[model samples]
Target: MESTHHQFYELFEQLGLPSSEQEICDFIDRHPLPGDVKITQAPFWTEQQAALLKELLKQDADWAVVVDHLNVALHH
Candidate 1:
């Protein structure tokens, strides 16, 4: 099976968010994820955005790596 690699910025875009490098950094700085909270449960995400993240993670989809990257960034 062929898998498509996805970029971090593309995940933001898919979530209907600002996808620019600086914008992504700014967003991460603004929304720090608590150690106990899952990225999909972050209050900053809209219902649809959270659903997408959850679905992607659950399926181990192409966007999963980028989503995991975002999750790590928010936890910092």
Candidate 2:
């Protein structure tokens, strides 16, 4: 699971944020999913980030595998 978390590196880098695997984890820890909001809908995402997330899930893209890992992390 920790390794799967690193799969977000390319995404965070594309967003021009701290892109290290550890930094991404830290960010997730800092900005948790709101009770009523989906992880992809969390305000921390930019429009592009949101869309990418949706598209990844929609198409069952390779990234979607890691995104699903993240969704699980968000819940617990």
* Residue 40, model 1, lDDT: 97
Candidate 1 regions exceeding 4 Å error are none
lDDT of 2 by residue, 7-58 (tens): 6677677556798778978887887775678867878788988887888789
TM-scores of the models, in the given order? 0.95, 0.72
Candidate 2, which segments miss by more than 4 Å at Cα?
1-6
Model 2 residue 10 distance off true place after TM-score fit, in angstroms: 2.6
For all candidates in order, the CA lDDT equals 0.94, 0.74
Question: Once model 2 is optimally superposed onto the true structure by TM-score, how far is the C-alpha of residue 40 displaced, in angstroms?
Answer: 2.3
In angstroms, what RMSD does candidate 2 have relative to the true structure?
4.9
Worst 10 residues of 2 by lDDT: 1-10
User: How much does each candidate deviate from the true structure in C-alpha RMSD?
Assistant: 0.7, 4.9
> Which has the greatest TM-score?
1
